[model samples]
Target: MTATAATEHVASWYAATANPAPERPALTGEIDCDVCVVGAGFTGISSALHLAEQGLSVVVLEAARVGFGASGRNGGQIVNGYSRDMDVIEAKYGARTARALGDMAFEGNRIIRRRIEQYGIACDLRDGNLFAACNARQLKGLRDHKALWERYGNRELELLEGEALRREVNSARYLGGLVDHSGGHLHPLNLVLGEAAAVESLGGRIFEQSPVTEVSHGEPVRLRTPQGVVRAARVVMAGNAYLQGVLPALEDRSMPCGTQIITTEPLGEELARELIPNDKAVEDCNYLLDYYRLTADNRLLYGGGVNYGGDDPADIEAVVRPKMLRTFPRLAGVGVDHAWSGTFLMTLNRLPQFGVINGNVYYAQGYSGHGVTCTHLAGRLIAEVMHGQGERFDAFAGIPHLPFPGGRLLRVPLSALGAWYYATRDRLGI
Candidate 1:
């Protein structure tokens, strides 16, 4: 996974239907810039885009291609807010911190839409997402969720149950659901690629297949790759899960987890519409949840299950197909066109960690499983910090992060056991 060895995009539906993009050259020599960004996924690209728009000299270095990590290989749902709810934040971090985060919870979605319109990035932009409930407890939770979001000034939500919920999901698996009118889904890879193009258009430089092997944090930060070096006044570590060896401090507090997805063959317009009447992205209420949405080509893209140590399942399809069948028994014999897995960084608290090291090197990671929107927000917050506005960023940085209790050797099994307990609770509906 290091930048020394070149890697291509994963063999997923997103890659198969990706837009034609030019191959960016790897860094060959030392380059100087105002800022050097590590990792060209959503956070790196988004941070670069925001800074470049401000007319700063920005350089991006990626271990592989742009959006090669969780950015490209995600559920693609623009689910707003953090992995933990606002109430959870309030309980742990105080009301002021909760208010600050709540205010910016949905800003990432706005940032995305603005980029789409400003740059004309076409990634099958759609509207609306549903949070499905599997039982009465979850159904009531969704009701409270609606009220909680509304309290935070998010009124673009509606609670639905019984026949009304069926109209949205068309599945017997869910007892009820809540819809986020502002939340939605899209082609994530294309979105990041388009944003990278926009970054270049703003005069930012991005080097693909350029892994930063070593980082010397001083007055002028130095990032070493196999073939070249980047010298800059400041550095932003946005590598998330794939970012290993360079900064063990960041890696120590986070664990990489893998999630698998499978896309079925195009079911035609009629069946696709029948499957999702409104075509909104759907995620069920569970400790380890299943999320799904329809692609522009009318295929049902379904994903679920997690491997705590970022280990790929023996057969991605084998792990996900049964879940798909359970959701839609009619698709028993549906041929899967693509199956893939992507790793995302997970923290014990299920909240992102943002901080500065040595007063110049900044980093944001550990979005847990709620990264699609948060990563973009992280970029904006990082940009604000670089611009000397640290109030908002401090709110996130103020939240403390603890390392996995079992450390590297035993962290996976310990986490898996904890997950099993909650998942069992979810199954029993207690």
Candidate 2:
């Protein structure tokens, strides 16, 4: 199976404001390395940086550009923990596994901060994230969530209610909220581009516009791109939803879901703070959630609404603008400057799928909306495994995942049905 080149970044507000990255040449000849990683998104770049730091020769191939996928076009919130949360992991994978996974949950944010400081990556980093609850039940859930996370060793949290909550968000929509001081947001594309530069500084190679077309099993696994081939002792597939059909097994274990984001014209400093008083990123508590934050230029970037079949909405603003208006009615007439969509891989259980294939082939996907931070943690784990340290990698790999049911013929419809059920539950204030 061959993966196709995306050719360019999606038309997003991020692209317009991104720090200029030098155009890199495509891979045109065969090369050998200690490790060959496919996909130059967060996971692949993070892994490449770590592997290079470990003194391993590394090369990364991207079907498009680095951060071209979800890594570049996401809500930007540094959400704490996995998408499934620690309680779910504890129930499904046992306490031991959950503890290990929990320990690493907040490390991604640390890694981001460390790298930003060490390499002087100017990505407009922020300091907090807010989880708002629409109803009383949801408020109680936030209270419970704070307690749960506290028990899991995440103590940098505060619960707010009534006026406190309203003051936090400057909106009457939420009855209460849970603020994680450890959680925040940043410029997604610039973060990845900076990491790519850091990887190059460490002698790691990255090939843009090079899509893998084949993977053959052998002592040195062989990977083929259109104009180049890579023969490495090990191969890692970190392409996520953008991997296309190159690897059937990974495709089977995950489904691509498209989500949209719309950025309004810059609100200026005063208006921006008037919308979100403290400038914290926020995501509401709902099955179909809406997440938003103020960009460095003061634009309100709001995103949500999922398409299970992975089809981009004909008009991104038509799908997302209403959600943004509903959240901040004061911005009803605000002009949207850019709109775009990106695909993310989701598993049945909403946990990331990590494991080995063909012995030396390692792949991790299905972050299920938690890709931002989890990808960094995953990269470190993969690099560690390559260096004869597999404890952390084994913990995540041991988790089980259910493949999409009914295959391609009915998996999407089935998933949509499930989504409808949960969305209804959310509407009813459950």
Candidate 3:
């Protein structure tokens, strides 16, 4: 099965404001390396960077530009933990697995910060994330959330409501919220682009517009692209939602979900602060939630809603603008400058799917909606296993991931039905 031809990054607010970067040439000849990574998004770039730092020859093949997928177009919130929280992991997978996973939950955030400082990458880092609750029940859940994370040794939390909560977000949509001081946001595209540069600086090779069309796994895995082929000691399949046909097994267990975002014209420093005081990223607590943050230039970058099957909505702003208006009614007439959508792989259990295929092929995907931080963590774990340390890697790989029921035909409606059920409950405040 051949993969789709590589393309350019979607035109997004991030892309418009992105730092200047050269267009890397496509792979056109055979190459050999210690490792060949498929896809140049966060996962592939992160993995390549880590391995290169270890003195291993690494070549990354990207279907599009680095950060073209979710890495460039996500909510940009550095949310810690998996899509499903630690308590869920503990309940379903037992304490040992949860402990292993929890230990590395916050490590991704650290890796990002370290790389930024060490490499002088300027991604406009911010210093906090707010989890706003729409109702009393959700607020109570935030309290429990705070406690659950604290149990896992993360104490950089503060529960606030009424005036206290208003001070942080100033929006009336939230009854209260929990602030994760350790969690924050940044320019996601720039972060991944910087990481890709870091990988190159470490003598790593990254070929853009080089999508792996075929894989022949063996002693030395062979990956075939349109114009070239890569023979590597190992292969890392890090193309999340965008990777298709090249690996049917990975696609079977995960469903690609499209998410939409719209960026409003700069609200000015004063109005931006009034909307999100203290300049922290904010995501509400709901089955289908809304996440928004102020860009460094004070533009309100807000995103939400999900479309199963990775189909971009016809009108992105139509799907997301109302939610933004509801959150900050004061910006009712604010003009939206850019609207776009991107796809992220969602697993049945909301945990990332990590494992080996044919023993020499390693892949990690299905980050659900929490790819920003988890992808960084995935890179480190993959590097660790390659270095003969598999304990942490096994902890994630050992978790079982079942394929979505009803197969391709019915999976979308089935998942939509489940989302509708929870969304109904959210509306009823149950």
* Reference-based TM-score of each model: 0.99, 0.98, 0.99
Tens digit per residue, CA lDDT, model 2, 1-430: 1354467888898898899897888899889999999998999999999999989999998887889999999989899888887888899889999999888888988888888999889889999999999888898899889988998789899999888876668877888899999999999999999999999999999998888888888989988888999999999899998776778866777899999999999899998998888889999998889999999999999999889978998888999988888888999878999999998988888989899987799988899998898899889999988888999999989988877899877889999898899889877887
Q: What TM-score does model 3 achieve against the real structure?
A: 0.99
Candidate number with greatest lDDT? 1
RMSD after CA superposition, every candidate: 0.9, 1.2, 1.1
Clashing pairs in 1: none
Of 1 and 3, the candidate ahead on lDDT is 1
Task: List, in order, the clash count of every candidate structure.
Answer: 0, 0, 0
- In order, the Cα lDDT scores of the candidates are 0.93, 0.89, 0.91
Model 1 quality (TM-score): 0.99
Residue 11 of candidate 3: its Cα lDDT? 87
Query: In model 3, how large is the Cα lDDT of residue 115?
Result: 89
lDDT of 3 by residue, 27-64 (tens): 99899999999988889999999999999999999877
lDDT of 1 by residue, 1-430 (tens): 4755438999999999898888999899888999999998999999999999999999999888998999999999999998999999999989999999999999999999999999999899999999999999999999988889999988999899899988998989988899999999999999999999999999999998888888998979998988999999999999999888878887768999999999999999999988999999999999999999999999999999989999898888999999999899999978999999999999999999999999999999999999989989999999999989999999999999987887898889999999999999999998
